[model samples]
Target: MTNILVVNSSALGPHSVSKALVDNTVEKLKLSHPDANIVIRDVGANPIPHLTADNVVPEPETDAQKAARSLSDELIGEVQVADIVVLGAPMYNFGIPSTLKAWFDHLLRAGVTFRYTEAGPEGLLKGKRAIVVLSRGGFYSEGPLQVLDAQEPHLRALLGFVGITDVTYVRAEKLAISPEERESSIAHATTEVEAVVNQVSAAA
Candidate 1:
């Protein structure tokens, strides 16, 4: 059975557009693979502690550091075992949420998830697919604002660093612009999600 990992990084909880898109995508995936195991980690609700000196150091760490390391291990383990990863990431200040960044910090471990090679750094975890659902207040999919949108590029770089190069993005833009814009954005995203589902189903 396929092991699917869903990471939610929206403080708005159920009201988040990213979460809604992810939920719809996951549901479609389930229909395609009934036996797939889905695991969810809500980073926004239970934020991961930011990386600190104690957590990075190997000797004589504090209790908080130990806890942080443990959580990091767990997060890495999830990524290691997942066949497909789904991220519900909303743009915050033209970037990803700090909670999601903290999660990425834990997963990007040296000698574990990635290591330096003669040519460059090589990722250890291979053969995994990642799907990112992004919700934005402004229209950053294209045009001048696209240059300022760092969320998708950051996620792609970080995930690629960990060997997840097959990444797809489903964007819902201009969500806060107007009621009509919000509806159209969500509808377009939903269509994209369905297309992805159909593609995955066919591949399966």
Candidate 2:
């Protein structure tokens, strides 16, 4: 059986294009692997508290820190146990949402998710694949605006840092270009979800 972990980080809730993309992606995965167990972390609806002085892991192990650390442990465990990870990210001001960033901050732990060695730093969580669906308001997939698009690159680096290097990207761009373009991008992403599921089946 496959273990799939999904993260939805768009604040728009019902009206989110990214959430729609994520739902489609999960449905495709289900069709491919009927026995797969899915765990969803909806950070948009319940945002993880940003790491602060109070929540940072402490040697003394304060009550607040303990609760924060436990949540981090749970988040890291989800990624470690999953065979596939599907996440939806909507661009905000040329970058990713702060809520999503907070989730990453909690999951990334030294000697837990990653480690340092003689060769160099290495990620601990291996043998995992990530499918990221990104929604952008402007033309950021390619062209002059690509450089300004910080969402995908940041996500890629973070995923790689945790040993999820087999990453695939599905982009919904030019959402704000026009109403017709928004609908077109969504229709295109829906097709992408099906393609991704067939293109990469469960590794057995």
Clashing pairs in 1: none
**After aligning candidate 2 to the native by TM-score, how far in Å is the CA of 97 from where it should be?**
0.3
Q: Please give the distance, in angstroms, between residue 7's alpha carbon in candidate 1 and its true position after superposition.
A: 0.3
Question: lDDT for model 2, on a 0 to 1 scale?
Answer: 0.89
Model 1 spans with C-alpha error above 4 angstroms: 59-63
Top-scoring candidate (lDDT): 1
lDDT (tens digit, per residue) of candidate 2 on 46-79: 9988888765645527888778777888998999
How well does each candidate superpose onto the true structure, as a TM-score? 0.95, 0.95
Clashes of each: 0, 0
